[model samples]
Target: MRRLFTGLAAGFLLLGTAACGSSDGSGASDAGAASGGTTTLKVGVIPILDVAPVYLGQKQGFYAKRGLKLQLIPAQGGAAIVPGVVSGQFQFGFSNTTSLLVAQSKKLPVKAVANGVASTAEDGADFAGITVKKGSPLTSPKQLAGKKVAVNTLNNICDTSIRESVRKDGGDASKVEFVEMPFDQMPAALAGGQVDAACTPEPALATVKAAGGKSIASNFFDVSPDLTVAMYFTSQQYAQKNPELVKRFQEATIESLKYADSHPDEVREILTTYTKIPDTLLGRLTLPRWPAEPDRASIERLARLAQQDGLFKQSPDLDKLLP
Candidate 1:
């Protein structure tokens, strides 16, 4: 479950000025010299397992070695972070592909910079699942019709996947009511009879199961197979103005992703430093597939799915959206 931060206006204002001042009018770089001549880049991210590589990069000095100082700012969801990136408050942001595509369709000047997370088919490694209370009468996605389902955000990955899952199961996807709730609060909400089911992502999925929630369906199984679930993005201006900085950021991120892929224990240990998830539960949390580079095909597949789900008026211009 993700914890959302409250105040960002003040931070946005302060950072926006800094970011604009750093640009030299040539679209050559987003990094600017601070007190010690180090370039500081503020990044907006949700505090989840998907962002583990970002934390790992910081902890291991992968970005610092490239003369980039990363300011990892946490937000509740993409709704908050996308605006920060668009307004120059954050030089870059991490969000799901669905949110970014929606933003791009609406003409938000953002381009994906790096891969964030992906899904896998390995047993016990389902990163997201639709869960119901233990021994609930709802045994399958079909039963979810006319029932209230909780998701971290509306019209994003969780909601879209669950809707598709229901449709694939011969359920009336349109009848399934989707309620917006934070992943962290979903378990309690489910247990309290507030929501019939929850489309939850790990480690919230793990936490909910520990609290007696049972999985009805794996969200990724039907809607998105080996999907590129999330990605790191920056404004179009930032990418064009600072290609070198973006390249360096991508390099550091890929290195961290590879490191995290090979070292699960270390990744979990680093995750504790950013997320409030307890150390004991970290071992049980399902980890996402951390790709070394963003896959255009997977992203295009997601865009098509989002379009088919009515999330967009028209297909997003992948040529311009992908970086």
Candidate 2:
């Protein structure tokens, strides 16, 4: 569940003008200068379920202990965050594996330092699902033929997973048209009949359902097995320039993941601050485990999905992309 932070806007606005400086701490071997002798880190994120670890790290002060002052930037989408890293606007950001893989294929300087969350198998009772308005003619992927479908972004996880599911369900994915919409607005758009179906992750899925939408498919892993839904990225330049700092960032994130895994109840209590999801919707949502290390095969599969979905023109060398 994503938390709703009332003060988040102020936080982002304040951090935007903050200075970069160096720190005396031992975490990052290659440190950059920031205010108060802290190595500043700018991380990009989309307000969604996969951002639990980021919130955990921030609230728990995991980054601070590593001699890093982390700044969180709420981005438009996973794909939209890539350029921030590539252009040095952010040292690292939370992005889906598919986007990172596609970016790497084009020789973008990026690497997945940590895994965010894994999707469950189909019919696994997870909140991630393909939803349509109640009483809509589209009861399954087969009915979506030649219909207008909605995704948060094309070629990203939302569209890719939906396409794969449709293909497996005897639907011609090529015949379907996709339009971009944010997770928060999916319910309104669906209710307004802007699209036939929406491929979304919760609390959007929950929202659509609460507003009388029917779920046709659930679990992203059922659509594509071992899908690495999201991850944190640092450019090749950032990694090379600050090896110890990147490693420290990774270590802190791993610790936060462990805490989130072990303390789900505590996580739920503070979720409203990061996301607008209500407490009643929390029980239905399933938060997947965060991998301790990045899985190369999953990253490669995302690359292949990107290529299959026409997001990337070529497949990247998976082995060379891993840190």
Candidate 3:
């Protein structure tokens, strides 16, 4: 299996903080001074709009008002982001619930304190789906047996969702081959016929759809209804050391979400500044909802799935990982 971080450093350069919502450690707000002279927050994020609240907060001066200086690191995927938080490279990182739950189940020591986003079948909700070439005979998950499928990573949300989706359709997941393809490369890979199917999130999903590919299965809500698909997670040590900062960060992020909800076009403009994806693609992308309250049940289901997949042999105590 190819390590997910292989292309991350270069990928970061391509999509690194241009229209960034990240702070540069400068003290610019009264709320920030109350927390500390400069409450520096290093964050890991993917390019998708689920973290729009954080970006909105940064743009709207919420973080500044709280006196927090945020340094945003655009992570390659959930697998790479989890290690960054566990090792203290980032005070907090955005990740899919599956990856964080798996790490926590295996004793990596992390906690998810805020709600992220959920992928419903709504018009703008970005979820994972199996995409095949337009003319391919494979139109259903059951037809994927013994074929190659690409995911951002194996043993993570993309893979877990794909597998569960196949099982639901009476297909043997073990009989199929899983490949690792980054979001940027998936389109070309599919166009070149490198893989029969690809599992991805938007705007990559939109990219595939635009490339004349068809979706066979979409499992964002089906696999786990009201699931906390992705969220902001941190080490317990950070929370213990900076409870006030964490609270302020959450407040700023929530405020940002509200702003983005009211100003979708402006948020898309902000996204183009930070991501390699163009504004037109951003317009077609499906974004997740930013909730204020963290959902405990969705997180618990993540732990259970991780154990079932052998990502962990035993369940880690949930109390140690909650705020």
Candidate 4:
């Protein structure tokens, strides 16, 4: 996968701090004292449309103005970043709500610091879907029974939602097979008939559709209306020990989200710098709903789904999991 660290590195330097830490034992907090005692935060992120706000916030100096320096480390998926956040290798991280809930169920010390991406209201843009190649016999979710489906990660949002969608459409979700594959690769996978269908989010959704793949279902809405797809989080110890830092980070993130919400063109432009999605495809991508604050109801719903899906032995304590 192509990484987009160049622009992020320059953004950190412009904020008067090195993107990565120096050798003086000042790792995440390596900001110079002259920069108003700035704290450098190593953030774990996936290079997808959902994380555009973080990049936009950096480009607009939102975090820097709040005495924070963000170094974005790209991971293949949310599950891969959980260990880093727990180990303090990443001071902050982004992951889907289901992944965090599962981690919290196992008593991981992670707590959400801010909201990331969400689903739109009914009939709004489809940010996530199950795509099948055009002219395929499958036209509805019910037809997916006994068929193979592709998801970025197993036992995460994609897996959970796809099953829920198929079941809701009267299909035997248990009979369906799920294959793990990266979102960016789903388009090719679908075209090559590697999987019967691909569960993907934008711009992969757009990419698959552009390549003659038709969406059989909107996974986000099918799972729940106005679903909170992902969130930003930190270890519970880190948030409690540095409450001020957490507050500043949240404020900066919210500001950036608002900017991305209001300026789609600019957000897409910024995404082009960090993601491998081509400039022409940027205009065709469906942007996820980047809400400024985490929604309690949405999160609670996810926990309930996790319990139903048997991902958690019991529903996680939403009060402790959320910020």
Q: 232-305 in candidate 1: lDDT tens per residue?
A: 88888777777778888888888888988888888889877877787778878888789877677767777877
Given candidate 2, what's the lDDT at residue 291?
62
Clashes found in each candidate (C-alpha, N, C closer than 3 A): 3, 21, 7, 0
Quantify all predictions' global Cα lDDT against the true fold: 0.77, 0.71, 0.70, 0.79
* Candidate order, TM-score descending: 4, 1, 2, 3
> What is candidate 1's TM-score against the reference?
0.88
What candidate 3 gets wrong by more than 4 Å, as runs, is 1-36, 121-126
TM for every model, in the order presented, reads 0.88, 0.86, 0.84, 0.88
User: Alpha carbon lDDT of residue 164, candidate 1?
Assistant: 76
C-alpha lDDT of candidate 1 relative to the true structure: 0.77
Error at 138, model 4, angstroms: 1.5
Better of 2 and 3 by TM-score: 2
Candidate 2 Cα misplacement greater than 4 A, ranges:
1-29, 33-36
Report the Cα lDDT for residue 301, model 3: 72
Report the Cα lDDT for residue 203, model 4.
Answer: 81
**Relative to the unseen true structure, what is the C-alpha lDDT of residue 45 in candidate 1, on a scale of 0 to 100?**
89
